[model samples]
Target: MVYTMLDKATLLPDLLRRLDKLPQGHALDLRTYKRNRSVLIRRIGADAFDVTEDGFQKERFQVPFSGLKKLLKVLFKREFPRSTKIRLYALGAADGDDLPTGRKVI
Candidate 1:
């Protein structure tokens, strides 16, 4: 699922909680900020890891709870939504006057 920056803020807690429940075998992929983020969990026996982006742009490591918390605190410095700009495009409108989008006001 693609998430806007705002969506990420709301969803992060839930994601973290879910990760807490997963054993050392299950895997998950998480994208945070506008920056590309992905992780793979390979059960090489019985251990967990924190994977990062390629190109040495980011670093991944094995993390305990404290390490995870610290990583989160440091990595979240960038404000994704604030930095990214989105242009909404509409294909057609009934009147053809303006592109229609967003929720209807009731």
Candidate 2:
């Protein structure tokens, strides 16, 4: 598999778009550069997801599709502030299995 490196400017939107296209029964794990703070997003419904944060609070909550973007922005700012690198992994996923996934790095 090939991985595309994302600079600070494009990482946010790219990650948001990728996460939006995630298929059902799939989960995406995102970790900071040092693997210090992480977030787990599990799709549970067409407009719902279980978001788990392994940061200071270690909290988990359900966020709707409408709020995903905002939530991501907040999480990124809070957990990934000043981070120069980020790692993302999609669990139980295959390359080229989905249209968006096929075109984007995963």
Candidate 3:
């Protein structure tokens, strides 16, 4: 059956309540360039939290958006487990050679 706008609207309050119960880090980082393309949540750091959505669902330590769901499943409900990896891409030459684009990593 098709869902009505009213249905989603009714669900919004509960969704917001669930979101609020999450840790500050669990708030989706809409500020990130990569996440601008989709609707997703993001966990910023390693921390455990008790999240209650609506009145029926209660989850702990939920993570946010991931390019790969595998990472989310494995890392679910845990703060920064071990070390967090960071990735960076730079401009290359037209021939895909390592060009001196003058970009450097800190």
Candidate 4:
């Protein structure tokens, strides 16, 4: 398979546009990997998200949600590769006290 480097400058705008359409409580689960390591990003809000190592919930932590342009720039520079395939999921609103199953958005 061929791997292409993702252009953060161009990708950020489209990503932000999509995120804006989601409901307030929706979440996006981003999964990326390279060789033997993987990273997970659970974007829970338009301006906020949580990061974890290899999908381990126990290792998750909240990350400040800046604008999409800035966030993507940072992610591209520091974390994901151009070929990283991010699987986005839209989580439904939880009931009074329960976690919701995420539905695939794309």
lDDT of 3 by residue, 1-106 (tens): 1111213223334434434454443332111122111122323333432221211122333434222244333322232222222111211112212221222223
Alpha-carbon runs more than 4 Å astray in model 4 = 1-10, 33-66, 82-84, 94-106
TM-score, every prediction: 0.46, 0.74, 0.22, 0.46
Candidate 3, superposed: residue stretches over 4 Å from native: 1-6, 24-38, 43-106
Q: Which candidate is the best by lDDT?
A: 2
Question: Which digits, one per residue and each the tens of the lDDT, describe model 1 over residues 1-106?
Answer: 2222334445446546655665554444443333333332222223344434322245555766445655554444432334233211112112212322222222
Candidate 4 C-alpha lDDT tens digits along 1-102 = 112333434655655665656455544444343322233344466566554443223344566555445644655455455544544434445332343233
RMSD of each: 13.8, 7.1, 18.0, 7.3
* 23: Cα error in model 1, Å: 2.2
Tens digits of lDDT, candidate 2, 27-104: 777776666677777787777887877775577789887888888788878887897777776674533233122113
lDDT of 3: 0.27
Query: Candidate 3 at 84: error in angstroms?
Result: 38
**TM-score: which is higher, 1 or 3?**
1
TM-score of 2: 0.74
Model 2 poorest 10 in a row by lDDT: 95-104
Question: By summed lDDT, which 10 consecutive residues of candidate 3 come out lowest?
Answer: 29-38
Error of 2 at 1 (Å): 10
Which candidate achieves the best TM-score against the true structure?
2
